[model samples]
Target: MGQARSQAEPVRDDSLLEGTIWTPLGSASFPAEQPLRQGHPPRTEALPERTATRTSRRCLAAALEAEKQWARAALGAIGDAVLTIDLRGTVTYMNRVAETLTGWSQREAIGAPLSRVFPLVDGKTHRTVITPGRRAIEENRTAGFALDCVLVRQDGSKLAIEDSAAPIHDREGRVTGAVIVFHDATRSQVTLERMAYLAQHDPLTGLPNRALLTERLSRALGLAQRHRHLVALLYLDLDAFKPINDAFGHAVGDSLLQAVASRVQECMRVIDTVCRQGGDEFVILLAEIRRPEDATRVAAKLLAVLGRPYCIHGHQLLVTLSIGISLYPDDADDADALMHNADTAMYHAKRNGRNGHHCFTAEMNTRPLQRRRTEPGLHHTLQPSQLVLDF
Candidate 1:
């Protein structure tokens, strides 16, 4: 009977072990070896399955953390300021550049309306700039625009920026938000304005140079032709300038020339143009002249201005100009031809005597011998008929 009981006890324990909860280390009996009372079998509790579920949840949490890290790194790398706004123009996302440009951190910027964070104005008119986020939400279309604007920083300083905005869309092909990109353009814009100024002005005299002078002359010529009026061209050559340059050196000569240019400019009307045609020569364009006497009066004024002595570098330099006057249509048709005839008359003034003025005439072109005789210090023994003609 004892042997039979031992054998039955082993079978009963084996059955209990199979039905009870088991760990890797050991197995636990559910009833703790108590005498069998009712007809209920031992209950089994799940342990490994619960541990597997907890591990899976931990792995999923780690993956999400890694994705967030990557997204932050990418947002910080962009050079331009980037801002994302919702349909109502409320800020949703802001990159590092945006924070720096707007003088607000991401914590301060997000959830705030765009107008409250960064006010915008039109590039030209300084009025309120169009809101792309509101438009995108209202119209449900892809809207975009670019403009130059001033952004007020947190410290109350202003920054010049070029801003571009585009509508942000969702997976359903519906516009839901807006993304704005902006960058600094102050230095570039200033450089462009400086270049434009240099292109139109002379660096030396701070005056409009040949290119600007030609443009003005073209307009003046058109007006003169329309009104059937005469325009005068005055070609001026500095008399004995080479001697002054040789005696006082180039520095003093340049100073004297600048002084002479200033004096000549002061003598002219605002409607006239005075331009330096290289070294020791200048060209003047006088518009709306009614008679030849008007050109003579301007020529006399130029001579008086240039005839004065200039004190440069403690040296008194006496300089004078020989001016030649040529009337439009009487001398030639266009600017080039008129300039040429004026130059020819200047040579006549130089030959007659430096520091004088002469008007161009057709007779001067015909009588070559008389032109030669008019030169300064050219002695010719006059015959009886020539003496009578001169008287």
Candidate 2:
């Protein structure tokens, strides 16, 4: 060699670096450069290592792009709502479900403050609630909304929702943003409430059941004792329910019971509670009363309203109630004793005469024992075939 020529320098390819690419932090776009045309392929044997390295990088980029696309598709196809926010507390992404739930489109929500896009409030107090994403970012961990959290949408409508938020971190373990996932919880919340209502109420009449009545009675007694007020309990039994149930079957009997519950509720104040203690028996609670006469007036009004004819299933049915009254601290101090005394008084009203009311008395307690010992059985006195019901 006349003068040893320096090894030919390899030509660098700028097309690969110029292509647009996406990353979690950001993305960019650029016009694609056309490939160079040559008469023949260049010999790469001289620089096989450089050629292989470039080819590997191109394949890796293509794989990464495919994975990114797959992830985007998966997120968009999910049922639950998904949202992402940047480090500046601004919205960056919203899935289709998120758009539908928050009533905000991704185009309009992007770059907007997270609070403006996803507002929340307490379901009970209606107070503003912090977005879970904000909490996750501040705390650098996962967070979730409390039970009964409500989401206020863009159109002003509110939705009951459940959600969780987690901080999104980069490869270097630095928190770059936050992501939230949520779903509508309205149906589940309604189901829970309906179950609770059914547990404490009569399914037929939709009135408080025996358990609820007992609970309220105990509460009323506690408050009465503290406030020095009198609480009254009225025990009532249908005067002619058995014969009607036997004659018309349970359909008409159930309807009559519903009507009775409705009328009893109408006669009561908001403070009073009316409960169905199964079958044709009901109990009314007067949370507070000034005198025994107040209880008597309520009983009288109930008798008059209930005595009216009820048109059920084309049958004009007439019914009456035998109501017995008892007072807390006067008849008995405890709920059970008060209930027992009222029940005894109800039996007294039934015996002396049906369709009337009576106040509990200490002497009346002995009457039931005496009558049961001296008189014949009630079934022996009246037969099912001989029983005549008025309708």
Candidate 3:
């Protein structure tokens, strides 16, 4: 369909629409000057049929132009980019957002190949990803880019985009063209990543937190169950951490913790997971363990590396860890129960001695519970708003 412009007439231009029929893609001339037309001749008995035909043609063109304007306005008002292409994959129209995103205006983008104007590639490998409009044409249905797709703009810069295209069909249900819609996804992706990090990580140490630890353990257990492998869960508590933080300042303590996390990572395999369970406590998961002794070996290595003196801002200080060990299947039924048993063992190690490791025993659970229950209460302390006795 073509857009109409105003003109005076017996419309010298034989075309039904005297004004420019604006379709670079459609069958019409763009904006131009029009020759003036004089008044029509008086009606005759024989001329009525011819007059009626011209009137019908004029009405049709006007209606078509109105439809074209409505479509353009609707597409332009959209916030997301919109691209339209003809059957040959040539770009037919692009709205304002599309122009900004592809860095090509409607005037320039028209008649250009969809790939030339809107190229996408693999975000990591930079390999050419299939152009969606062309793909839709080939598939004869809606098509979209894969995850981590990057759009290559006219200026040669890249942006993450989520876009899809569907073939436009003719009156007979034949695919005639395609319309694609897309939006920039960079900010949304970044926000999602940031939220994920904050939800599962310790802010001070940048290590996975208790919530993430449980998740990792669950996955590890699932894998171990399938592969019939041993999974080791270690809960570590830094020895003398409270006094070190109180005497050396919290800043130094945080620095030491960061250093400790770094060292711990270095000591483990890439398949392993280490998460901080808040404040001087960390959990490590070794998912590919072959035997029970594999955990003890790792515990020994961790003690050696973490026990090394840390020089934080010129203050030389030594630290050690008390680790609790629990094995999958051998210790507990589920990840949470496994970690709980490991945590109980950690406290057992702490009570018996500092800077050592303890394996979970059935009795360890009862001992810690008994200790907590027996600890003296502060019920004798005076409470506010209580009745006073005149002794």
Q: Identify the candidate with maximal lDDT.
A: 2
Q: Model 2, range 1-391, lDDT digits (tens) per residue?
A: 2123223344366364444342332112222374323543333344555555666988999999999888778999999899999888899898999999999999999999998999999999999998899899989999988878999999999999997999999889999999999998986678899999999999999999999999999999999999998999999998767667767779989999999999999999999999998889999999999899999999999999999888778777788789999999899999999999998888888888779999999998766543231124443454444433364
Better structure of 1 and 3 per lDDT: 3
Please provide, for model 1 over 1-391, each residue's C-alpha lDDT reduced to its tens digit, 9 standing for 90 to 100. 4455457554532334434554543335434676444753322343565455556766887998998788668877978788889878899988998898889899999999888677766667777766655665677654554466677676767777775677888778777788787767786688899898788766665566778778887888889899999999898888766656766678977887788779888988988888887777888889889998999998998787777666678765666788888998777778877877887788888877679999887766665533231333322332222211111
Q: List the global CA lDDT of all models.
A: 0.74, 0.85, 0.81
Rank order (by lDDT, best first): 2, 3, 1
Q: Considering TM-score, which of the candidate structures 1 and 2 is the better prediction for this target?
A: 2
TM-score for all predictions? 0.56, 0.59, 0.53
Which residue window of length 10 is worst by lDDT in model 2?
A: 22-31
lDDT of 3 by residue, 171-250 (tens): 89999999999989987788899999999998988888888877888898999999999999999988766666766678
Question: How displaced is residue 137 in candidate 3, in Å?
Answer: 23
Model 3 spans > 4 angstroms off: 1-183, 369-391
Misplaced by over 4 Å in model 2 are 1-80, 84-97, 105-131, 134-140, 145-152, 155-162, 168-177, 183-203, 219-230, 242-251, 289-293, 367-391
